[model samples]
Every structure is written in structure tokens, then in C-alpha cells.
Target chain A: MQSEFAVELRDVVKQFVTPEGNLLNAVDHVTMQIKNGEFFSMLGSSGCGKTTSLRMIAGFEWPTEGEVYIEGKPMGHTPPFQRKVNTVFQNYALFQHMTVYQNVAFGLEMEGADKNEIEKRVKRALEMVQLTGMERRKPRQLSGGQQQRVAVARALVKLPDVLLLDEPLGALDLKLRKEMQLELKALQQELGITFIYVTHDQEEALTMSDRIAVMSKGKVMQMGTPVEIYERPANRFVADFIGESNFLEGKIKSVSADEASVFVPALNAELSGVPMSKDFVNGEEVVISIRPEKIRIVDADAEKDGVFRAKVINSIYIGSDTHVFLDCNGVRLKVMEQNHISRLDPHSFYHKDQAVGVYLIPENTLVLKKEA
Target chain B: MLQRLRENKAWQGTLLALPTTLWLFVLLVIPLFLTLVVSFGRRSPDGGVIYGFSFHNYLRLIGYSTNCPAGQSACFDPLYAQILWRSLTLAFWTTVIVILLAYPLAYFIARSHPRRRNTFLMLVLVPLWTNFVIRVYAWMMLLREQGVINGVLGWIAAQFGLPFQPLQMLYTPGAVLVGMVYEFLPFMILPIFTSLEKIELPLYEAAADLGANPFRTFLRVTLPLSMPGVVAGTILVFIPVMGTFIVSDLLGGKQVILVGNLIQNQFLSARDPTFGSAASLILMIMTLIVTYFYTRKFGFGEEIITA
Candidate 1:
């Protein structure tokens, strides 16, 4: 059975009055659903309204126009403390004066729980975050990662209906961030609580989210699994945003159930893929995006296969792999090759300014719909 | 040798602090040492130091001798101790009153919007910009029998056709307290406000999310975080009020005498520098002990608010 949505925002709009007498819309009419027991993420750049949307669900802010519902109950003008949601702010917002135990027990104290129960839940939550003995330590005494875990424990101890994390890993270094991402995903799974994560980092969204809603300009552009977002992006923005991809402008020549032929102007050749939207007609201008890894470097003399002759612009050695950049049909594409015994052959290393044959698999090419 | 000198950071720090060390030695250490010496020395008939070591000065502090036609003989007096006790009581009450009034005002200023906060702070500080003597005189004028307060009270009574005289409000302990609080109120507000203002808003939000409501958040987070200011303000207001002579002299008239007024009398009126220095040294010692106690109790931990 599918888990029900724990938090839902229906056509919510949030606006702020600017000093110039203009109403600046931070979050437009956006609707979203976060499933219970799932680590859902709102992924976007700064000023993309992802945080605002999360804050709406957390009841920190009331929508200018629309309703937010938690567990199917309408939440109208509810303050943050009254809501069954806790947020982990980017800075970890720990109480400077409180010990970790006191910070974690804050919610329980608010609920007027018995002292024993508060202590038990706080201990349990701290244990869940792997901060058992550090409960009595002040937040400043902890490292960034430990402080972040304390913030998580503070929210988790409340057993809120949903845990909202707003760039919780943004302050961490790369290695710590990667570790916390995995720990957070595992913690979400173990606690069985809905986690609504907000971040502008695409790698964070890809690594932790069950599904991500790609936001831009105060609106959700696409919502899908990370693989789906990378492989079959609905529009040009998603294809460019999710990962490294090279695009070519083309015109649709023909359409079929499984494939669509487009006139590739650079190579004067026909490109084929399944268009994401069916509304595209003949002679419609479209963009085709092919992931960099899809392009393969082949020997120019290796049989006249479906390949184009190109020049290698640059080659980079990245420890475990070598990235070869080639200019194909006036478009730059990168090909990554894992360093291995066979690849160690002297002739296998392609240098810059060398002529090479680049082949792109038809199935790997993504046909994107034009966004108005 | 150059490299070794560059590496000697502890020596560099000590060198940097040398000026302050010398300053303290000259201003603080020397005077205290001198005061101790004077407390044990004898005072001449003209109130100058005779440089003779004796217990007579100490004996004279508790009870002096009456010089008749014969010679100096012992008499008894406990008035100084009683005065010291009264001074302690006044200082204690002044601290309590300042804390009670300063807390809410400081809280409001600390949490208010930037523009409004500055405006409110300006209001609190406006009275301080005027001359201290003038502010005290203003209070003196208001509390006097023929002043605005009594005139207003008399007018109200006459408007209602009641037979009554203006109430005696000036020259009382209440008037002294009013003047002391007015003079020192801003000292209390500023420190508490600075501490409260330094508290991050997210801390309060975090506290609330942990299940605290507004008041609980204030008690747990706001109060404790602002303890530095509260303690600083308390010490600042208490020490000065204890040593203050103007409020009691102007308002208490001859009805009451705080320790500050007594110390002032010993310096100027009694012209007994030896006894004055002894009492002054006692007050200074009390101040140092209280300050030491507060600093030792609260030195290097999170500021604690008993509330």
C-alpha cells in the first residue's frame, strides 16, 4: 500500500511587501505533496522559493492565498510551535545557553510531558542521532557535524509529523556533507517519519531524495525520481540542471509512437528520440540533450559506424577516471573512461588536438519539450 | 636568536600588558596599601597623619576618647556599624528595584524592530544626557511641598471641594529611592538590553520547536542568555547606589543618612582623614568583596538567570 502524504500545500502563494510598494512574490501558486515515511526534497537555486514552500508546510509562514494541510487536516493560520512539524535551519539554530539534553527536551517541555517521559524521549532521540554521551555538552563545544546532529536530535525528539530540513548540510564540508546525507537518509528510514528536505545542491537532492521537485522562479518545474529527472527531463531547464548535458537545437521532421526524427542543423543529419510531450508537431523547433557520458570515443579507423569525426579539445585525469572533451558538430561533449589495465595502453590515451570519432547512442539521447 | 624572539608569544603578551599592570599598581595597589597603613596610624589634633603605629585609630573607629582638661579617655559608639547596616539595606533594595523595572523595558528594546528599538533606547538615555545634578534637582523640585506634585494634588482636592493640605512627600526615604532609581535606571537598562539583543532569534525559535511556548522560551532561553547583562547591570547599579551621597543628602535631609553620606561627612565635615580613610577603605573593601563574589560565581560559564 502507498503511504499517505504527511504534508500537502495546495496552490499556495506567499508574497512580501517590498520597500518600493511592490508585492514581491516569493512562492507562487505552487502545489506539492510530501509522502509519509519518505525523504522528499525541494531542489532549487537561491531565491527559487524552495525554502518558502518548506516554511509554509512547517507553519512558520501562512500562505498569502491557499491552504496547507498536514495529515489531511487543514492548517489555517497556525503558528509554528502549534504545528506538528519541526525545522532544521541551515545554521542549526541550537540554543546557545542550553545543553544538548535541554535542547532536545524543549519540545517535550512545551507539551507538558512528565519529566521521566521527557528525559526518556530526549535520550532516545539523542541515541538515534548517535549523540548519546554528548547530551550534556553545550552546542558550541561540538563540531559542525555534531552540532548538526544535535539539531536533528532536537527535532526528532519531538516525533513531529514531518521534519523539515532547510539546507541542513549546506554549512558542512564536502566529505562531511556526503556522510551526513547518507546518515540523514538512514535516519529518516529508521524513524519512519516524513522528511521534507530543501536544498539548492543538485548532488544532495540526487543522493538523498526519494523524489525531488525541481523548483525555479517560485514554481515547480518537474517532480520525479533522480534517475527520471536526469534521463527523461520534461523540459530544457531540468535537463541542464540535473547533470552535465550537451544540447543541440533541432526541428522535428517526423513523429512515431516510439521515436521522433529531428533535423540536426549542425551535422546536417537526422536525430531520433521519444519526445517527452506529444503536442510537438512537424516543423516544430525542439532541443535534444545528450548526457556527456553517452558520447563514446572510438578509433576513427574502426569501421564506418554511426559516428561523427571530431577533435579532442582537452583531456583531464581525475584519479579513477580520465575525462576527454571533444568538439562534435560544433558542440562540446565529455566522455569519461575508467582507468584500467586495458586503458593503460599507450595508444589508448587520446591527447588534445587529435582527431577522434564520437558516437552517441540513440536511446541515450533525450528529446526535451520547449517551455514557454 | 631572532627566530627565538619571534616564537616567544608569552613574553610578547606580557610586554603588551605591562602598561596596564603599572597603571593598576600606581592607581589601585598603591592607594590600597596606603589606606591600610593609614588605618593603623595615629591622627594628629589637626586631622593630619602623625605616622605613629597604634590600635588607637581602630579603637577610635568603634568608640573614641573624650578629651577633657585631663587627658584622652575611652568612650563608646556603635553608630558607624548601624550606618553601615542601613547603607547595605538601601543598596540591596536599590538593586532589586532597578532589576524589576529594567527587565521588561530592556526586553522590549532588545526585541523591538531596529527603528523602534533605537527610538525607545533614545528615550531611556535622554534623561541621562542632562546634567546629573539638574536631574536630581528636578526630582527635588517635583517632590517639594510647593512643587508640581503637591500643587497638582492640592488642585485635585480643591476641585472636589475637600479640605486638605498638600501631603509631605519630600525629605523621606521614598524620595531618596526615587532619586537613586531615576539617576541609575539607564545603567540597569543598557547592560540587560545589550545581552538580550545579542541573543539570536533562532535560539528562541529552536526552544519553541522543542515544545516551549512563548513564556517558557523566555524563561529558558531569553533569560539565561541575557544573564550577562542582568548581572552586569545589577553590579553596576548596586555599587554606585551604595556609594551615592547626593540622593540621600538632597532628599533624606537630616531624617536619614546612608553610608555614602556618612563617608562624605567623615571626609569633609569631621575633617578626620584617618577615620575617613578607614571608613572609605571599609566601603571599598566591601565593594571589592561583592564584585569578587559575583565574578567568581559567574566567571566562565553560560550566564545563569535564576528565573
Candidate 2:
């Protein structure tokens, strides 16, 4: 029977011995399931166990506690060569001595494929990466981007079930990295193979991944779609990591099916219709996460239920939006407004220390669990 | 003035090269020119130079002889030809054996942990701290018929109440080869170790992830990448083994004569400076020819050193 999941990690743990003679868990009990043909990403900073998790899936490392399943088969201490998966390294580890053709054909040659079949597959692989007619060049002779393409082509030529990428675009410049991001996403869709990417860049993960697992200190913080992760984060750590959030510490007063009323001490008022991540008990401590774009500036004298008076400290007018920094009582909050009107009028922008009325939309406000 | 001097790159280059240029001219160029001039001139009766040009020395070196046997007008002596061929063969074997032994040892040291690798490298270099001749004498103590090796075997035989005779191991071609390999083994190991250590760990992972077994990864990735070191080690071991006479003199006794022995005999024992100069010129030309071909096929291994 064919399994629905392409890869599964069941409570996997990896422990390492530190130089100071202490045992440390590099991968702490991470369990995740990546669907077939899905683009799954592990997002975290360095030493956050993202790369270690990818290595376990590729069989370069075996879990210390649980098991890793590839295509529903238990992968227990299997060597990398025996596994049907490939990895695109962070450094684009192309063979320096071999020509592009030879490097791309290496896997086929190891399998003892016929000469004609190897040539056909290698040419097609190079063409897919847009490296045609450059087969005679060694890796050192090519530019960094071209070498990275060769690495991708070398891994893709094998046509494995899952492809693991460990920050493959880390070495490229910003413009090129952005371009390759789109190209990689397109390639994944065209080939319809499962991709397990590891990276610390939040924007790259948000733009390309079908589902993302935010990891910190060897533990999975949260896993969800980009919209869910950005709009309604599971906890304070997820809210703070995925994007900028102004947190207002509060206590739950009442809860319904989808919304809850939280009494925020900083604002000295009760916030109603706040989206609840999970059911909360009465008087439990929580944090209300409000995105900068969700707040709007109204007339200072307007009478609104959720409106508060604040003094603008600074305003920065970028091309598409204007960032207004304000201080309400003792708490500082940032408000982002789109530059939809008054492009050339300097009078329309908020000045320093100018009094303004801040309105918070309860629909966009999220109630998260307070982190210790 | 300082700014102008700094701006002039040509002047800076010339000033930097001045000392080494003068040193090479005085120490190397003049001696080589003198050797070339003496190779073409004639030898006087009392082992003195005669200022006259002739092709007699070159012709005699290729086997033409003036001192023919009593029945013949002219004869061909194959002594110098045989000695040159023997020296080439000995150098070739010594280089091959050294590479076989050094590559594995170098790999072991390069793959070892960082703290222990230093200790292993120091052990490889420890033998070089003693004098070269003294170390060769140490080998003599081990290889001699009545020395340590034979003495151990003889004692073992006496314990069993059996008649035993010591094997003849010293003063043979085999002993000379052992001495040459022992002296040049480090030269082979160091360069190979440098190249092997410079390889990034990710390349091995890439190879394995692309469906290559451990042995295939070594052949396809490790061996091809470390070739520059092998080339450098061969050059260092071969050139010195070609011109060394002391090892042969001590180990080969009078059985195996090489081109170095022939040249030494010409200058010291035979008192023929002209023939010795001719032999020296031939040895230099042959070494240059072999080195040229070898480097043209493989690189000069400069990348291995700099990398």
C-alpha cells in the first residue's frame, strides 16, 4: 500500500557531547509529517536544529530516540548511499575537478546506467537548470550562481522521492537569491516532488514554503500555513518570530467560540472581539498581539469605543507605506498606514509629538499564550 | 619622493627582486657555466685542464672507447650506460614504494582528530631531527647479517634446538632500496597530507548523497582531488634518489653501481675531471627532461601547496 505521507519524523532526538564533557540534545523530540509533493520548510536561526532535522531525513544522521520514515518505511541507521533522497548543500559543493557533464552524470554512472541513457538524462538536467552548452566548463570556471545551478542539477538528475536543501541560496547576493527563490518554487511545482528546505530567512520561507515549521532551541515552536502563522500565531514566540508584533500583556475576562474579551492593563480598557488561539480560563495571563498595519489613526476628538489618545514620536514615509511611531501613556506602539493618498502633501503626515487618536481593529488582534 | 616611489610599481618589483637575483647569479649561474665549459674541454696528462675543444668526452660517454682490447681497433663499453639505466630503475622503484606506503599513512593522519593529528605529524618528522648519515647507520644496524633482525631470528632458532644460518640482507640492492625509501618516505607523506587535509568535508557528503559508496567516493572524489600531492611527492622523492651516492656506497657494497657512483669514481678515484663534468652535465639534462615531461602531464602541484 502506498503511504500518504512522503516523510515522517516520530519524536526524533539527537544528542551530542559537548567539548566540556556535557551531553546536549541537538534535536529535541521533533515530530512532523510532510505530505507528498508538498514544499515543507524548517525555519530557524543557526543552531536551532533545522539542519539537523534535514540531515536525519536524508539519512546522514540517525535519530537518538525515535525513528524517521521515508515513504512510510522506517529508516533505521541506513547509510546515505542506500537512501533514495538527495541534498543540495549550503556551499554548493560541486566537484571542483570534474566538468559539468561529468558532475551531473556521476549518480547515473554510479548506478551503472548505459552511456546513451546517462547522456540523455544529463543533458535534460542541465537544460532544466538553464546551464546548457556549459557542460565542458569546470566548477571553478563558472560564476557562483552557475555553480549553484550545477549543484541543483546534479541533485535533481537523480529524481529522488524527496529533496533536502540546506540554505542552498545562502551564498548568492540578494537580487540573485530572490530570483532563485521563485525559480526553485516553480521547479518544485513542475516536478511535483517533495522539497524539505532549511533556512533562517523568514521572508524566504514565507514566500516559497507550502507549510513552515518554526524551530527554536531544538524544539518545534509551531507549524502551519504562512497565512495562519502570520495572521494568528500560536504563541508569543511564534508571533514575535514570524513578523513584528506589539504585545500588550493582559488577562482573559470572557471567551466564546472564536473571540474573547481581554482586559489589557497597559491600555486600561477591555478589548472585545479579539481572536483567540485556544480556549483560555478566566483571569489567566495572556498577551494580545496586534500587527502594525492593523492600527489606524483617527481624529483626536473622535468618540470611538476602542480608540485611544497617543502622541506621535516619529514618522517615516517609505514608498508604499508610512510608519508612524506613537506613545500611548507609557507603552510604545508602531502603526503602519498605506500611502494611498496625499503623495506630495507634507501636511498630511504626522509630525513629532503631535496628538493623534489610535484605533485598534479587534478582528485583526490575536490573543496568544504568555511565554515564560 | 615617497609617494612617487610607491606609485612606481616597476621600481618596487625591481628592488624586491634585487637580492635574490644577485644570489642566484653568483651561487648558481657561474658554477653551471664553468661546468659546461669544462665538459667540452680536454684533460691534460696530470689531471689538469687543457684549453681545447673536442667531442671525445661526449662520444666516449655514449660507449665509444679509445682503450680497445688487443685484437680490436675500437670497442663499445656499456659500463656508463648500464649504470645510468640502473640509477633510473632504482629511482623509479623507490618513488613507487614510497607512494604506496605514504598515501595510507598520510590519509590516516589527515583523517585523525585535530588534537591527535599534531602528534602524528610530529612522529613523522621526528626521524629528521637526527643527522642523515647517522640515521642511515641506524638502518645498517638493523639490516646487517649479524645485526638486530638476524640476531633475533638466530635466538629463536637456538631456543628450538635447530641449526640456523643468518640471511644475507645487508650490502645488497634490496638494502640500498630500503635505505632510499626510508629516507624519502616523509617527502612523499607531507605533500599528500596537505592536499588531503585541504579537502572540504562536504564534498564527501555530496558524493555519498549522489549514490556513491564509500569506496567509490574515495576513488572518484578523494583520489582525483589529492593527485597534485601525489605528483609533488613523486618529484621530491625521485630527483633526490637519482643523484644520491652515499646510500648506495654503504648498502650496495661493490655489487650495484649507479650513475652517481660512476661520477664520483671519475672525479676522485679515476682523476678524470673532464669525464666527471661530462657525466654531471648528462645527469642534469636527464633530470630536466624527466621533470619537464612529468610536470607537463600532471601540474607542478603548486595549487596543492598554496591551497
Candidate 3:
């Protein structure tokens, strides 16, 4: 029976020797399964092995210890040409010597397709990317966005079982990158091809991926749907890497089934939070993290379960949200208030040294194990 | 004063070019004009130019001889024509062999580890440090009948208890070709290596990622990208090989009478500067025509033509 996963990396590890003669694991022992027609992304900053993982899937690299399986078949030393996958490179590595038509048709020609077939498919691919009239121009003659689209068309023309994109929009400007992100998502859906994308941009992954594997160092820190990863992070690294969070170091005052009350010295009161990981014991150290946007600034006299009186340290008027810095007891927290109503009056905005109440919902506050 | 000098860009440019321009005008332009003038003159009885207009030397180069069989007014000797043709063929064969030998070595060096590449390139250039004539003499030592190669063969035959005769290797066409190949090899390698090394690694990955095997990638990407270097090396090796006489003179002995040896004989031995000047002009024209056609086809070696 064939496995359901389109690609699987079983405990794969890739090691490299730095120039200074240190053995480093570029991709640590990691395992993942990507379903067919799913848009999966490996997200991390540079040197975090995201690209290395994608390259191993593309057959440009081999697992140092384990095996990579595609369609339930082990890819043991199979070269990229023999593999049923193609990659749109980070820099749009198009053949500068070949014209756009020739570049897109390169893969089909390698497969020994006849002239009529190559021409028809190349024309169709170019049209899919909206580059129909750009066939005769060379790669250098096109703009960056156009070149990136050509790279996509070239890789997609072969209709591989899986498509790998290594930060394909990294070279484009911000505005163009956003547009390509939506276009790429729409394209992936229309074609129903499995895409293994690698990028360091967390927002891009959150925007386009069916699931994101946020990596740090050389290991997968967390892997889940975008909302799951954002709203409920697996650890401190994932929470901090995904979005801005205010972390308070504290000792567990009491432990319940899924909730823990942590005694934070900075707050001078026991704050209740849901533990992200299990095995929470009383007097154990943990960090309670609350996202900046999750905090609310209510009236000082309002009675709330997770509310504390605080003085506004500063305020910044941003269009979508107003960021208010506050000091509650001895702890500092940044509260983001969405502009639900127009604050035309000057007093409507929070001013310096104003008394306010900072509220952190027990469910929204994540109690995570403290990492060194 | 410094600001004034920098402000006049045209004057600064002229001043910077003064040394080279004066040098070329005196040493290159004046001599080339003199050679052309002397090419049209007649030969004196002595070794000086007679200074008269005639196409006798040019005509003789194409096999027309004023001094022929006594009864005939003119006849084709085919002597000068044969020498020119031999020179052309030798240069062509030498260039072809050098490229065949140089390209793989150059590619190997370019693809080697970065630290070792400099050492390999240095090895290719080490032979050039020796004098050209001395290097030709060294080839003579290896190709002579009693040379190291023949001595080894003789020793091998003696061990087998078989009688052997010393093989005549020097003063032959093959020896001349070998000597030429050895001398001009580095010239062909450097330019090819430069061009091959300039091809980015991503181009190869792109080709392989597009379903091309290693062989196809080399053919489609590596070969086309490195053509500029091959063209540059060809021009650099071909022209000099055609006009060089020391190799053919020493290694070919009396057997190889190329245009270079013929030109040298005219001025020093035959006491005919007019003929030598005409021959020199013909060699220059032949080299220019070949280069013109080659550059017109390949675009002046695509910016790496060292010459």
C-alpha cells in the first residue's frame, strides 16, 4: 500500500564543516510528512536549516544519516533530474543565455518532448504566469517580478509531483512580494500540486502555508497550522519568533488540571494561565507569555479576574492600533488597542502618567517552560 | 595648481597618454610605414634596400619567378608558396592540438579546490619563466637521437636481449609540432580557465535542476559560456605560432622551411631585405585576415582577449 504523504523525511540530518574546522549540524535529526497538494513551508531565519531541508527534499542534498521518501519510494542517491520535483530558486536562477521561451521549455526538452508539445506547454505556462508576450526576451531583460514569475513558470511547466520554492519572492520589493504571495497561493490551489516552500519571513509563511514548520538552529521548533502556531505557540522561541510577546519569569504557585497560577515577583500577585506543556508542578519555574496585542487597557475601577492597576509610561498613535506602554506594579507591559472608534479628541488617546488597568486573560496568557 | 590640472579633463587625458602615444608613433608606426615602403622596393646586391617600385617580391611569393629556366621569361617556382602554405598548416595543427590538450587541463584547474587552483595555475605558468629559445633547446635535448627518450627505449630493448637502433626523433615535423605545443600551451590555458571560472555555480545547478544530467549541463551551459575563453586563447596562440621560427629551426632542422625561417634566411643569408619585408607584410596580412574573420564571428573574444 502506498503511503499518503507526498514526501517524508525520516530523522534526516545534514552536517557541514565550517571553514574554521568545526563540525556543525546544518539540519539536525528531524522528521516531517507533507501531504499531497498541501502548501507546506519551512520557516526560519538564515542558517536555521530551512533551505537545507528543502534542498534535501529536492535531491540537491542527501540525508547524512536517514532517508527521504517520495511517494513511498526511498530516494537513495537519486539525482535531481531523476526525481519528480522542481525548484523555483531564491534568486530566480534562470538561464541567462536562453530566452524566456527556451528557459521555460528547458525541462520539457530534457524529457525529450517533441517540438509541438514543448511549444504548446511553454505557451500555456507563460500564459498561466501572465508572461505571454515575453517569450523572446532574455531573463536579464525582464524586471525582477517578471523574472520571478518566469522562474515559477519554468519550474511549473514540467508538472512535477512536487514543487519546491526557496524564498522565491525574496528578491522582489515588499509590495510585489505580497502580491506574489497571494498569486502563488491561488496558483498552488489551481494546480493542486504539493509545494515545499522555504522562507525566513514568518508573515509570508503565516499568510500562504497550509502548515508552517518554524525552525531554530537546526531543529523544527514547532509545526502546526498558522493560527495554532500563532495563537498557541509550543515554546518560548516559537512565541518570541512568531510575534512580539511580553514574557514574565515566575514560579508556579499552584497547578491544576490544565491551568497554573504563577507567582510573579514583578507583578507581586499570583497570575493564572493555561500551561502550554504538561507536567507543571508547584514551585517550578516557568515563563508566562502574553502577546502585546492580546492585552487590554480597561478602566482602573473595572473588576476583572486578570486585571491590575498600572500607570501609562508612554503612548504612540498608530493608525490601526495604539501601542500603550504601562507599568503595573513593577512589571512593564505593552498593550495594543485597536482603533475601533475614531479618537479625534486629544484626551481620547492615552497620555503619559495616566492611571489605567491592564488585563491579561487567563486563556490568552501562555505558561511555557523556561528555556536557557 | 592641482585643481587646475584636474579641471581640464581633456588636457589631463592627453598628458597621461603622451608617453604611450609617442612610443607607438616612433617605434611602431614609423617602422610599419618603412616596412611597407621597403616591401615595394627592389633588392640591392648588398643587404640594403634598392628603393624602387616593383611587385617582384610579391610575385615571387605566389610562385612567379623572374629567374626561371634560361629560355623562359617567367615560371612558377612554387618554393615561396610552399613555405607559406606549410606555415599556415603548421599553425593550424598546432593550435588545434594545443586547444585539445589545454581545455581539459584548464577545466580541471578551474574546478579544483580554490586553494589548490592557484598552485595548478602556477604550474601552467612556470615553464614560461624560462627563455623561449632555451625552452626550444630543452625540447631539442628530449627529441635528439641520443636523448633521454631514446636512451630509455634502448635500455628497455637491452633488457629484452633484442638489438635496437637509435630512433631519429629531432629535426622532424612531429618534433616541431611537439615543441610548438609545449611552448604555446600556457597561452591557451590561462584564458580558457578565466572564462570557465567566471561561470557562476548557480548556472550549473539551474541546468541540473531543469532535468539535465552532468554531460548535458556541460554541453549546454559550460561549453557555451566558456567559448569566449577558447576564442581568446585561439587568437593568442595562433598568431604567435605562425610567426615563430625558433622551434622549427632547431627541432625541424633543414627539413621544415616555414615562412618565418624563409623570412629570416632572406635578410641574413640571402641578403634580400626587400623579399623579407614583403614576406613580413604578407604574414601580417594573413594573420590580420584570419583574426578579422574570427573576431567578426565571435565578437572579439567577448572581452577576455588578452591581445
* Each prediction's whole-model lDDT (CA): 0.83, 0.90, 0.90
The lDDT of model 2 is 0.90
Candidate 1 ranges beyond 4 A from true positions? A1-3, A19-21, A275-278, A301-306, A337-347, B1-7, B41-43, B50-78, B115-123, B152-164, B292-307
Q: Which regions of candidate 3 are displaced past 4 Å?
A: A1-3, A253-257, A273-279, A316-322, A339-352, B1-22, B300-307
Candidate 2, which segments miss by more than 4 Å at Cα? Answer: A341-345, B1-4, B300-307
Candidate 1 lDDT by residue in tens digits, A1-372: 333789888998999887788998888889988788888999999999999898888766789998999988889987778888998988999887778887787777778899999889888988888998997788889999999999998898888889999999999999999999999999998888999999999999999999999999888999988888888887889888888777877888988875788888887878766454556788888888888777777877656544788899988877777889888768777787777655666676788789988877778786766552
- Name the lDDT value of residue A239 in candidate 2: 88
Candidate 2 structure quality by residue, lDDT tens digits, A1-372:
668999999999999988999988889999999999999999989999999999998888889999999999999999999888999999988888788998899988888899999999999999999999999998999999999999999999999899999999999999999999999999999999999999999999999999999999899999999888898788888888888898889999999998999998889999999999798988989999999998989988888988999999999999899999999877899999999897698798899999999998899899988982
Chain A TM-scores of all predicted models: 0.94, 0.97, 0.96
Clashing pairs in 2: none
What would you estimate as the lDDT of candidate 3?
Answer: 0.90
Ranking by lDDT: 2, 3, 1
On residues B1-307, what C-alpha lDDT tens digit does candidate 1 reach at each position? 6687689998788878999999999999999888878877766788677776776655654546454335535456667776777777788788889889999999989889887998999999999889988888898899999999999888899999998787788888888888888889899999999988988877776666666678877777787877788789888998998888988898888876887887788768877667777777778777888778876887532646421
Q: What DockQ does each listed candidate score?
A: 0.53, 0.56, 0.42
